[model samples]
Target chain A: METLSSLAVPTVLILAGLVMARGKNAFDAFLRGGAEGMRTTFSLIPSLTALICALSMLRASGAAELLTELTSPVLSVLGIPPEVIPLAITRPVSGSASTAAFSALLEETGPDSLAALCAAILMGSSDTLIYVMGMYFSRTHVKKARRAVVIGAVGAVMCLFLSAALARIFFRDAA
Target chain B: MIGKCFFWICSVSMVCSVITGNTSKLASAVFDGCADSIELSLSLLGMMCLWCGVIEVFRDAGFVGALARRLSFILKRLFPDCADDSDIMGDIASSVAANMLGVSSAATPFALSAMEKLDKRNGCGDTASDDMVTLSLLGCSSVSLFPTTVVTLRYAAGSESPYAVLVPVLICSVICTSFAMLLSRLTAKNKPLGKEKRKSLGKRKERL
Candidate 1:
């Protein structure tokens, strides 16, 4: 599965090339499309810069850690492990940051631990919603993504709660 | 609105850092963040260009159209306005498929292309349309049948069963995606009415 997933992009490229053979102006079309993609990428620079900067500053300022500490009490009341609070907070904003936090959790509490398992489940089940929203909205030049952002946040919260609950159910014995 | 929120949060964080005597750390973070964002965008550029080129080939060869036709039934229900726009539909289908396979890097380009096409179809408005919101929802809560990243991380961490979280992850993803869909549907009807209504009312009063 790992090999196949890694090869998926190359496979699609090959197939696309084969399909392009039937067309007379494949090269021109490809270049045209590539140019369009570049344009989109360039347009995304401002929004991406703002968002990534904000997120990074939020992380580096220790605000994220403080927020996690503040939320841990509320989260524990809902049966969530205090350990996974950082992962929950970071997962939606930055992918690499959350992955690092997840790795730290696994190291702190063995991989077999309930906290590690919950972290794994939460990471897999949800996505970096803010990042995705920023990219998509910027690419499309959509200024008002208020609704999409709200909905994505709600979905992320659902994923967090459900993952924690399911982890408790499934890893009860392991913990 | 989202941009403003980010700005305020960022400002607040900077203020807190300064007050807490973390000025040096904050300065480094700003520089590092700028550099990181540039690197990230460049990497995204490479992937987007590659996939866009390939997809263009598919489009020229009619494969995209064929794929769109194949998935039209479901796509129609999900994005009714895009029923005739096979290019957009094809991009959406490919994006969702790649996401399901856990090839998220590949999915990004497709999703962006689909959003671009959807925006064009919606007359390039500044605000996102309902279809755009739905697509964003799907992208954010993408249901991955094979979460290779998590499994690999678990293996590296020396788990007895790296794939043990598979079932729970899948179930959780389904629930999350469903909730996203439901929320999108419920909110679709409640378009921001404040500015539009005030403007229209002012026009009506002036005419009267």
Candidate 2:
């Protein structure tokens, strides 16, 4: 896996080589592309700022924790292990919160346990659904993104159940 | 919808903070959040530009068009509206490839480019087309081939078989992506409250 990521540099060099072989100015193309990226980055900053502020306030005010605790009972009824509930709840809202919850889960459940396996898989399979929605939709002038959010949330929930089921099947002997 | 949700989140947090007597903490968080976002964007800008530049080189060399043509078999089904447009499909192809490879930094630039192209294609420029929703949906439910960060975390935590969850993660991601796509497609028929319709309705009311 590490080797695969390491290949990224070489892949870029190869593309650059291919461009140069065509007798065109790869550097000039690169500079223009970079300028385009700068524009995209600037456009994204406003929404990202608002989103991060709201989410951080949610966290700092302890509302996020309250919400998670409120949802845990319903989650438990769905067969989610109590140990992984916090991770699942925080997974879509904030990436850093979920990572913290994940490490906490490993600490509490032991890394080789079924709950830990489930948490790991859940983290791996899912992205920050709400954050992605905010970032992507910021690019367009769309005012209505409710349906997109609903669909993304559904996908996140699907990942949650699928992760638990797969973990239980593959790690039957795990503690 | 996003605006409403943002408003609700902020208001809810403020109310919760007052109730919990953590108003000071919430106040601090507001500034901290702004600072953090700028820091994040700064960190992201480097790799974002690099990947965009790299992809540009490929685009200049005509490699993107060839790759798009090759991937259109699958891309066509996912983005029927963009199937005939090599330019849009090419951007979408790069975005999807970067996502699958778990290079999210690389993916965002391409994804942004694709979103811009899709927005232009939609013509409305104000309302998000079905294709735009689907593209954003695709980014959210990432079907990564190698979830690098998760595996590394597991290994760091001393798991005996850090890679044991890889297959299951892959399976879960695939299932999630397909299900989301199906839902998006099903919901695609209904147009959102488009500006054109609203404008026409307002004119009709004014004449009345």
Candidate 3:
């Protein structure tokens, strides 16, 4: 599994090499494209800076914990384990933060625990909504992302519920 | 809209921290966050440069067009509003292909490029178009064939069966993606371009 996952980049490189070999002015095109990418990256800095600052503030202020605790009642009713609440709250906003939360959950509950399994599934099945939103909109200079953010959040919440349900069904006997 | 949200969250959090007397912690977090964002953007710059270059080669060799042609049937269905010969279609195809393969770092450039193409087609000035919203939604929903990072983490954490979550991840991802597509289609406000408009846009693209 590890070998297969690591092969994605090599496969892409090989394919790109084959295609470039057949193309005219491949080097020039590559350089131009890289320059364009650099421009996009330059434009991304402001938005990324703002969003990350806000995220850091939220984390440091313990707002994320507060939000998680506030939502735990509803999540518990939905069969989500208490240990996974922080993961759910942070998953959309920050990838690294949620991964940290997930690792903490695993360490606290042991990797084989049902909560750990559910956390893994939730983490795997959802993208970082806010991060993607920031990157995409910043690149395109789109001012209105409410619709995209709302829809993405809805999908993440739906996935969370589904992950918990599936974990219950699959890991019931083990637990 | 998102910018306001970020500002609001930052202010609210800052106020709360002040009220809670965590001023020192808040100050440190602000500096650390700025530093972290810069580091992340720099790393992303390298990855984007590499993949964008490769994508350019693919475009130069007409591989993207060929791939788009092969996948046009599904692409047309997913993005019916986008024209058949639009370069955006090829970009979208490449982005989705990279995403499903679980190489998100490689996927970012294609996704960003696709959004730019969609923005051009929409002619919305600075606002997001319906297709852009849909594409963004699609990008956010995890559609990877293998949840590689999650599995690796589980294994490192000493799980005996790290692959145990694979099936559930696949099922949930499919559900989330389908739901997002459905919602986006239902709520999309931008009307499809007229036939003449599409033709003119295609001509403009060709002239470029």
Candidate 4:
């Protein structure tokens, strides 16, 4: 209820702007971007949608819960709180879903919680490399990206690791 | 297409839950979760439109061209295969600018346009040169300094301190971005620069 209203505010504001700009070539730009977006969505969404469904089943079946339990102690050495495992798992897979997961953590456990902070930090800093990158580059003819791919994946993980480490440093008291 | 996929995923997940006799629980959970998601997406859409309009205004005011001029050096280093006058700079700048606003959707076309501009400039119709790949990859991993969409989601979800992630987000983005740039330079170095332009890419100190 509160969430939907807050969300509606921005959409309405943009709608107003769109109305104002409607006569100023906004409609054409919107349609063009929409069409292009639709095409690109087709290329990637099939596989991604399937994965999300599978993941949802996993989440429902408590696989994520089990995995979180399994990795919690090991990740404790890494300084990431147990609650952040979902973010570390999902952010690399789906940014939006991770955002939801992280926000739910905030709502359930309170926002200032170090785990929520780490999850938020990780989400903001890292890219959904597997999904977004794979989707985008599949459109172009890019074959020789071995080094780029390596650097990208490694850098994403490094950022994830750095987020956990720095979160512990910043929120040592909170933790 | 995505809509169909979503419909399918929902159906499949519902079937799975029913088989496990937890359909009601998961469905209710999904319903609540989706309400939040739709809202967040709306907020993101608005913020993205505002930023897009702002970027358009900046472009109208010659800021876009100025940015291209300012990025000539780093752009030169990152994309030595491209000429100074190429449209790749605009694409990169626009894409980066869009990402800065947390509008990944808005950034996509600009990124594609940028890559296309690079390919055309290098006269590589089929095989993308290494520089293009690095730039595209770097763009994909934009490592945003601020994540407005995520924060908005948090705030809407009743986060007590939505801004707490800001500092860590900036730090991690800076590290990842620097790491990406350094790695890109090392990988793409001296390969396309041949023998002449390689020297120019070295520790260039200049003001545009």
Candidate 5:
């Protein structure tokens, strides 16, 4: 995993070398790109602010816990570990909250425990679906997301179930 | 759609907080959330700029175009409606590549650029086009080869074999992404295209 991450930089360096070899001024192009990136970030702020605030409100009001309690029984019946239910629920909503839930689970269950492994797999396999949708759609004039939400929800639910099932299959003996 | 969801989320949180006598915490969360969003975006700025810069260089070097060509078969299948638009295809290619690398800061700019182009192609309509929905779905359920953040968190949490979950994550993500693609394609077919576009396509088919 570490080696994979280390490769990301070198890949960029090789790309830059190619750019220079092609006789383009790489540094000048980079500055132009940087400016464009700045504009993108600024445009995204309002949407990000709205989403983060709502998510945090959901987290703080104890609604998240209530929702988890309501869903726990069905989730358990589907073979999801009870301890990682919070992680599953938050995983698609917000990235930071899910990370916090993940670490909290690790601390509670111990890093080597079945629940921790399951949570790890769950967190690793999925992106923050709702957050990504919000950011991606914010720029568009599109009001109705149509079936996008349903599609994302389907994918996210599949990841959650697969994470639990795969963790058990791969790590049951180790646990 | 998103506005309604966001409105309800905030309102429900407020109502739940009041009923549970936790308004103070809720109030604090409101401020914290705003502050956190800014902080997060600012922190991401440097990386976003760096990667976008690299991507700009890639565009100039014609590498992004080459990538679009290389991935044409699958991308064409995924984006049937707008597959002929090389600009859209190029942005999608770069974004997907960044996503696979787990470099989201880089991915967002590229994906957003693609979204803008798709929006224009859709005539700046309020309703999302089929290709737009597919792009967002693909972005949401991207098949990331490296679950870098999760591995680091596990390692910090004292897991003996932090990378042990790599294969499982890979399997799960690949399956989920495939499912997402299939669902989007199926839904796109069922939704029915706009009248003019459909007729045009039919006419083109007849001509062919």
Candidate 6:
């Protein structure tokens, strides 16, 4: 119930500084955590960079746009609007990519669009299975990447359902 | 170092993204998108750094290890292949902690680490371990308390109905988690975690 998350890092730092004055162990703990935090974050660079780069290229080359154009008709049937298609397509590929798409959607269409809802559902419910599997599992020495796909597919379908159901019930902008 | 490398990579990629545009208008759209993207990256950087700090405090307090032990029960059910205590469990705790805050991107490495631990024990056997399957199936979904990306997207889009999504998302997360758990329970058994590991984990707990 009590999460340090509620406390800003500065406040936490001040508190920890008090705790530190009380005992060196607390300071040690904070330093250790910061070090580990930095290291773990650094490790993500490989996957994070690749994902951004790929998505960037996709966007730059109009691959995302073309893909959107192709999927637009199908997405239309799902009640997802045109502006939101990029987020939908990108969501499963990379969270950052989908986020970039969401930004564009928000910039172009406004956030209340039905498409934004769909994109959000996609992000909330889904995983970037391919990137995850490739990076995490590959290092873990897992040979097969197929299972991640299955799980990803399941997540995607569930997201699709949730989006549609919510759109039907809450999204009044059928126009 | 990695952060700097990736930051530049992202910047270049975004610029490349602009130039590669066959049409001119989309270049602006892509640039506009990057503004928010950069902000999100900063927030994630700040938030995740803070969590990492909290985790260190938890480590010093010995709370994370204890929490890991408690979670090991459920984890045991999911990853019979892994040791009782491990860095992976610690990672899972951090991952879950991050997930609670709507930092799924931050959680991926931990989830992968946890899965790797489970898979290590998966043993090149005929059937995949039940725990491995459950971990895969249960996975991570956005829970109720904090749904940052959802809120952000809505906010960015200028949603009059931004908060309107809270209930539906909360309910959907619960239902989907339950559904995945149920299905994992029914199917994973035939694959592995049958009568044996269940009894084994129970005995282990009794001893603990």
User: Which candidate ranks first by TM-score, i.e. highest?
Assistant: 4
lDDT of 1 by residue, B63-92 (tens): 544554565676566665565577887789
Candidate 4 residue pairs that clash: none
In model 1, which residue pairs have backbone atoms overlapping below 3 Å? none
Better of 1 and 5 by lDDT: 5
Clashing pairs in 3: none
- Tens digit of lDDT per residue, candidate 6, span A2-101? 1332333346457546656766577677666667666655565445444444444446556556656887798678666566565655565565556555
Evaluate residue A40 in candidate 3 and report its C-alpha lDDT on the 0 to 100 scale: 72
DockQ class, candidate 5: acceptable
Q: Name the regions of candidate 2 deviating beyond 4 angstroms.
A: A1-74, B1-70, B190-208
Question: What TM-score does candidate 2 reach?
Answer: 0.63
Write model 2 residue lDDT over B1-208, tens digit each, in one string: 4465468778999999999999999989889878866865565576567656766666676664465456668766777656568787777887777677554666788888888888777774676788888999988887876665566556656777666777788888899999998888778854334566457657968999
lDDT (C-alpha) at residue B161 in model 4: 60
| CA lDDT, every model vs. true structure | 0.74, 0.75, 0.74, 0.62, 0.78, 0.56
Q: CA shift at B15, candidate 2, in angstroms?
A: 14
- The A-chain TM-scores of all the candidates are 0.60, 0.59, 0.60, 0.60, 0.61, 0.56
Rank candidates, DockQ, best first.
5, 2, 1, 3, 6, 4
Point out where model 6 deviates above 4 Å. Answer: A1-73, A79-83, A170-175, B1-98, B101-113, B123-128, B136-144, B161-163, B181-208
- Chain B alone vs. reference chain B, TM-score for every model: 0.58, 0.60, 0.59, 0.67, 0.63, 0.54
Q: TM-score per candidate, in order?
A: 0.63, 0.63, 0.64, 0.69, 0.67, 0.61
- Mark the regions of model 1 whose C-alpha exceeds 4 Å error after superposition: A1-70, B1-72, B190-208
Give the per-residue lDDT digits (tens) of candidate 4, residues A1-175. 2354346446644654555464566555445444544454344433443444444554574545565788888888877678777667666666545555565566656766777777777778877766655664555666555666677777877887888787777667665
lDDT of 4 at B13: 60
